[model samples]
Target: MSKLADNLNTILQRIKELSELNQTSVRLIAISKTKPVEDIIELYHAGQRYFGENYVDELEKKSNDNLILTQCSDIRWHFVGHLQSNKINRILTRVPNLDCIQTIDSIELADRLNNNLQKQSKILNILIQINTSNEQQKSGIEQKDFLSLYEHIKLNCTQLICQGLMTIGSLDNVNTEDESDFQVLIQCRKELCDKYNFSINDIELSMGMSNDYERAIQVGSTIVRVGSLIFGVRH
Candidate 1:
C-alpha cells in the first residue's frame, strides 16, 4: 500500500478504536479540500467513501472530473464550507453525488436548499452548523438559534432532512480538556429532542477534525472531518 493508504488506514484504525471504546459508530469525511482528485482516487481505493470539499467551484470541477466519475462511483461528497446563497444552485445542479451539506447555518440557506432540492425532485440530508464557540468569524449560526432553525426546517422545508448538527467549536478548546463547545452541542441535541419529541439517536453530532476527532468521538460525535493528517499538507 502507498503512503496515502497508510495514512488513511491509520486514521481508520484509530477511529475504530475510539468508536469501540465509545460504543458509537463514527463516519470519517476525508476532507479533500485544496487537494487534487488523484489523491482522492488513491484514498478511495484505500476504502474511503466520503470526501468533503470547501469551495463551490472546486467541488463542481472535482465532482465532474472524468477520472473521478469513472473510478469512484460510490464516492460521497460533502460541502463542509459556508453555504453561500449565490452558490446554492451551482452546488445543487452541478454536484450530482452530494450526500450532505454539513454547514446549514441559517434558515434562509435551508429554505433555498429546500426549494432548489424540490425543483430538482431531490431530498437531501443536512446538518445545522452551530457556532458553539460563538466565534464571530466562524460560519455557523449562533447556538441560541439552533432550536429556531431546527423548528423552521422541520415545519417548512420539505426537501431537506435534518440529519444532524455540525460544529467546529473553538480552536483553543478542541484538543484540550475544555470541550465546552462539545457539551453545548450535546445539550442542544438533548434540548431539541426533548422539545420536539424526537429520539436522541435520530440526531448525529458532527464535531471534530484531524487533531481532536478521538476526543470528539468520546464525547459522541458521529461524523468527523479529517483532512491534512490523511491527505498530507496541501500544496
Candidate 2:
C-alpha cells in the first residue's frame, strides 16, 4: 500500500478502536491542505472521499484540475477555516462541491452567505462556531451569545441552513479532554435544537482535529478534521 493509504488506514483503525461500538459513527475528513494533489488522490484511492481545506486557494487548485477530477469532484469539500465575506464568492464559484462550511462565527457572514445564496439560488449548509473552551483567541461565538444567533438565524434566514455547531478545543493550559469540548458543543446543539424545535437528525457535529479525533468520536463527533495525520506536518 502507498504511504498515504497506510497512514489513513492506521487512523481509521484507531478511530474504530476509540469508538468502541458507540452510537456515534465518526467520519474522517482527510484535511488535504498544503498537500499536493497526489496525496489527495492516494487517499481517495484508499476510500477517503471527504476532504477539508483550510485555504480557499488550495481547495480551488486541487478540485479544479481534471486529471484528478474524480478525487476532487466526487469527494466532499468542507471549509474548516475562518471565512471572509469577500472571499465567499470565490469559494462558492470554485468549489462547487463544497459540502459544509464549519466556521460561521458572525451574523454578518451569515448575511453574506444568505445574500450570495440568493444570488446564486443555492442553499448553503453551515455550522455555528461555539467557543467551547471560552478562549478569546478561538474563532467561535461566546457561550452566552450562541442561542441568540441560533434564534436569529432560524427566525430570519431561510437561504442558509444550519447543519449544527463546530468548535476548536482550547490550546490553553487546561485539563479538559477533547471529548469534553465536543460534548459541550453537542449540548449546545441540543439546547438550541430543542428550543427551536428543529430536527437534529441531519445536523452534524464537526469537531476534532488530528490530536483529539478519537475522543471527539467517543463524544459524538460526526465529522473529524484531520490535517497533519494524513498529509504529514505542513511547514
lDDT of each: 0.91, 0.81
lDDT of 2 by residue, 134-186 (tens): 87677888877888887778877788788788888878523445366777888
Count of clashing pairs, candidate 2: 0
Model 1, 1-235: lDDT tens digits are: 8999999999999999999998888999999998999999999998999999999999999999999999999999999998789999999999969999999998889999999889889999999999998888888988889899999999999999899899986977755777888899999999998997888778999998887887889999999999999989878
Pull out the clashing pairs in model 1: none
**Winning model by lDDT:** 1
Model 2 poorest ten-residue lDDT run? 172-181
Task: Give candidate 2 misplaced runs (Cα > 4 Å).
Answer: 173-180, 197-202
TM-score on alpha carbons, each prediction: 0.97, 0.90
User: Which parts of model 1 are misplaced by more than 4 Å?
Assistant: none
Error of 1 at 43 (Å): 0.6
